[model samples]
Target: MTDLAGRTALVTGGGSGLGAAIATALHAAGADVVVVGRDEAKLDAVAARLGRRARALTCDVSDPASVEELRSRLADTAVSILVNNAGVPGPVAALTDISVEDWDAVFDVNVRGTFLLCRAFLPAMIERGAGDVINVASVSGKRPLAHRTPYCASKMAVIGLTSTLAFEVGPAGVSVNTLSPGPVEGPRMARNFRLEAERSGGSVAEAEAAFVSRAALGRMVTEEEVGRAVVAMLDMPGLCGADVDLSAGMIA
Candidate 1:
């Protein structure tokens, strides 16, 4: 068993979906969990569900001022674990049809936000001599999806960031790894597909089926599955700097 007792973890986007799962998993493993998101009510609800081990904070990962405030709230306590799980799936559109604003919005949260949060928390980890930084990327990072150009580009950037950060921080005892989840079935996924279905004049079920059929697994992946993978990574020793794919049989 990977013991994480007494460790302090900060998970961005913890108010919903995979972020919530990661936060819950970390808390269940005895870590002091801090859940961060833009929704204070949602964050509080998640924290309440997580019991005494979890703390909720509202922070917009894309905002530097909010992040600076978050750092101030943490004071001098060293954060042993940081999970950059906050990301926007981006508006679905053809590459040529994508608006500049949409592209910037996607990159701002997925790339710039991830970079800033790491910058804020990493120095303390370096000073402490050990830490875990889990960046929740996607299989889209490795393979592109049509009409998801901006999201693909942002995730690819995340993979690049993960690899580079891992190389730079491994020497300082900070293990940075990326987890790429497949078609995780949840509210967020449903919302994304719903929007696409509306745009394309198709049923949500059709959109979902299309997504599942694209995966070699022949089904939509579950939140629990992704959660387990994340918990597994956090528990592994000598598991730094790896892009572990949880895409079922998608690669083959």
Candidate 2:
């Protein structure tokens, strides 16, 4: 891993789960980290664990004004790393059964939020001629995941956004990439498994097995592994315009 001794990182959705894990990894790599999320208590909890090198900031990534406020708050800080991990899992139902509002909400957070953050932060990096951005998408975007059309579509937009933005910004020295993980065993997946079981009339274990069986590894990746992969991606200077899959051979 690269020794990010002088870098500063800002992570969205860095309160719990994968976001928290990524922030922890970046902190361990010697980067001063700012954990951003809607929950002050949760963000504070994460920052507290990282000691003086970390701080919490509150923001709604989907709201433009919220992002602007966050940018103003961080005017004095130089964030060299931006992790756009804030997302929402949309409704688990057939396309015809899904409501328009439900579909819009998913795109608002997953796609719009990523776009807003990048729009807010990328300029400073461009001016400085150095930065890294990892938009946390999912393998579902690249492949197929039944009953999650909104999520898959939104993530696919993020991937496309990253790829195009990378080419536009690489000449200016900033690197933009997407990190797509497969099934990471966590509260999120647990909830998803329960939902799948209810929909399929199967046990939760069976639902989980059905999903894991698709992966060549026959297992799920951990949040910690995803975090480590983020660090590894940062270490590679030439990795611009790429969507790196840490999917346990699920997409391989």
What would you estimate as the lDDT of candidate 2? 0.95
Model 2 — TM-score against the truth?
A: 0.99
Root-mean-square deviation of each candidate, in angstroms? 1.4, 0.6
lDDT, candidates in the order shown: 0.88, 0.95
Clashing pairs in 1: none
Tens-digit lDDT track of model 2 for 3-57: 9998999999999999999999999999999999999999999999999799999
Error of 1 at 52 (Å): 0.7
RMSD of 1: 1.4
> What does the lDDT read for residue 80 in candidate 1?
91
Which regions of candidate 1 are displaced past 4 Å? Answer: none
Q: What is the lDDT of residue 68 in candidate 2?
A: 99
Which regions of candidate 2 deviate over 4 angstroms? Answer: none
lDDT of 1: 0.88
31-126 per-residue lDDT for model 1 (tens digits): 899999999999999999999978998999999999999999997656899999999998888889989999999999999999999999999999
